[model samples]
Target: MRQMPPENPFDDDKLKEECGVFGVVGVADAANFIALGLHALQHRGQEAGGIVTYDPEAGFNSARRFGYVRDNFTSQKVMETLPGEVGIGHVRYSTAGSKGATAIRDVQPFFGEFSMGGAAIAHNGNITNAEALKRELIDRGSIFQSSSDSECIIHLMARSLQRNIPERMKDALRRVEGAFSVVAMTRTKLIGVRDPRGVRPLVLGKVGEKGYALSSETCALDIIGAEFVREIEPGEMVVISNGVVESFHPFERTASRFCIFEHVYFSRPDSILGGRSVYETRRQIGVELAREAPVDADLVCPVPDSGTPAAIGFSHESGIPYGMGIIRNQYMGRTFIEPSEQIRNMGVRLKLNVNRALIRGKRIILVDDSVVRGTTSQKIKDMLLDAGAAEVHFRIASPPTMWPCFYGVDTPDRDKLLAANMTVDEMCAHLDVDSLQFITLDGLYRAAGVPEGRDANAPKYCDACFSGEYPVVPSDMIAKGFEMKTAAE
Candidate 1:
């Protein structure tokens, strides 16, 4: 067994990536490679991890565990049980299913046995029409296994009249609405697909002359040294069989509205997308924030780790010297208990500490990627003030996240979001900061490489969290009387 690190204690005040999927074909130890790929994507989802491998001699083998990928997928004993030349893996943070022990049954790669052969699917993103489709499928006499919306695809594919698994998958997706990036495997083929609107991310990569891989991000490809071929275009499906790749476009073409949050926080900074580095994009976002909301401060201090890169950019742009005013305690585990109100109030201090020497008597600008619940920010401010910091300003890289994400990102409901319920000045008072300002929506688009700015009539990307313009109707939410822009309005 591999050594287990402490669970992440830092409950970030930001959106969480729901899942990551990976698949490989034409490799001797495909499960092994997939394990590494999933390890690289642990940031996407840390609650659970699983792998499904297909061996010519033993058929399909699966292993799922409710913890970090390193703890479950690494051991030689575990790898020995899953010998195969084709495999798929998934890391999940639970969007569609329950978070109890029963959740293991909902883990991917979800398997289906067709008349022709068996296929396993690893999916990322939520299906907006899942509940409606589930009801319809149940009425039509389909027995569901897990509550996950992803399982709806299996049921849909089972009912498809298409000639093969890939065609059947295409048929299944056509009937569903919402964001999805799927990696699937069969006895002889590996398949990858992205939603029509490209609300989620998927990439195609080559592993030397013999193998090909499909992954949620290029960072996964980099882990095993796979050369990224290209992003799987929105609405496109690619099938890899017998070491050859075939592309199919079954859905009507639409402007790609890839999730902007992926660049902001979901994806690893080292990963590249649309020929641009995610790290550089975030740094540019910081630069844009500095230009739009410069402040009079003695030091620019990052919240830590995720905010570090952007803070560097802010320092350069604002000509404010950056300092490590806050230091994170790496060994802290997520399982800390706050038994009382007083202990709960000290929760932020468990993960972070104020650097008294660096921040005392200095007006510090705290750079963070986004603010979700003002809880952590409020605590951080109190800590800095207690450390004798003269003033605490906040510079957020992204615009106020006023809307909830309906795709894959795990956003709190609108009422729970700090921005959704409060105005800028109200938020500053809530966070107890000297001043608080977020990068403008237009500035964020420019940093993401859209220089002309967002087109209100036809927005290019999913800024639903900021602009309340959803690319796809959230069917489940709509059924519950949830108006799209009502909160923002």
Candidate 2:
């Protein structure tokens, strides 16, 4: 049996985004550019990273390592081994297969050889129908490599009767369900695709004179000095070679439902999504939150990093002075080692500290992105009170995460979710905070530039984590006895 790695003691109580993908074609030493792109996307997946490049002489070369991209992919020796003009990479925190015990084989940019040619693919979404497909493939005598649902695509492609690699990819994806934004490469071409729902994100960028890149976010494109071209449309595929691009629509069309949480937390504030600035959207979320749930406090402080933008908006909208009442230790990485039980007990203090002088005698309004299990929130409240703060009010930027996301994010099961189990008042009491509130679902949609707010029959974006209205049914989970919301409930 595989043993799970010990959970990070200082892990924040928030949903984790699963992975990010980047690929470069028509560039010299493409692996180097891919490394920089992946570094910009490190926040999407910090546990492991992999890069694959193909050289005429070297054929296909790959390097997958467990750790941050800066720690593993920056070595000159490693880059030299992957010499090629076309390459693709992935940074991953597993939402499928293996979980905490991620093996190197489970790392992506998974390569497969076809009768027509060879290809490498890095996927950034969950496949809902994976188990059923895996079983069918196994029964047909396909040898499995890694435990990832993503590998099922490789097997499916291998079994395709299409005349070329690109066609085979379409054939494979046509049979897949749920969200996906894939970056893939063949010997001479780089390909990008988004599922019909557009539940995840993928963008095209132009690099130098002839090079083109595809990335999970435009922020990754910025690292390589690539000009943002446009997003890969939902149900669309683009193949690029020698500076030329070809477009294909392989799947049936549907209304796009890009993940809305990317604006709240998953994406970097600098990124552009759906032609709107992610930073501006998050700041607006705070503005709306202030309007919907106003609280009087001596100081408005953010939980640091993720909450900073929203806190700024909240402060501006509410006329409250903003202060750094809670300070985060910037040098602390998620992989920080805790050797003993005594050290482990230090918990959140290892990564955050209360500003004793500033917090003394102040009534604080703490702004955070979301509360998953409530462990971190309770600890932060205790820290504030210990530092002589008179009162602490909690304001969350997003609506309460009441449902688990089956579309690439690593969310806790519903039973473990704090909001799924408690009402707002109960949660406030549980955390021992003076007050607690979350941004309303309609407010969130408004902040994302939907002026009319969410429609009951047709949502503009994927807000399943908050509203429990999943666009794609999670067949695998349902088979495991997981219950979904009923209409009458």
State candidate 2's TM-score. Answer: 0.98
Report lDDT (Cα) of residue 46, candidate 2: 90
Global lDDT scores for all candidate models: 0.88, 0.92
RMSD of each: 3.5, 1.6
Q: Candidate 1 on 399-429: residue-level lDDT in tens?
A: 9998888898778777889998899999998
Q: After superposition, which runs of candidate 1 have C-alpha atoms over 4 Å from their true positions?
A: 1-12, 335-343, 486-488
Error of 1 at 90 (Å): 0.5
Candidate 1 at 331: error in angstroms? Answer: 2.8
1-489 per-residue lDDT for model 2 (tens digits) = 111232566884768888999999999999999999999999999988999999999999999998999999888988999999999999998878685453788999899999878999999999988989999999999988888989988998999999998999999999998899999999999999999999999999999999999999999999899999999999999999999989999999899899999999999999999999999999999899999999989899999889989999999999999998889998888677744889777888988999999999999999999999999999999999999999999999999999999899988888889999999999999999999999999999999999999998999999999988889998988887778888974
- Candidate 2 lDDT at 287 equals 96
> How many pairs collide in each candidate, listed in order?
0, 0
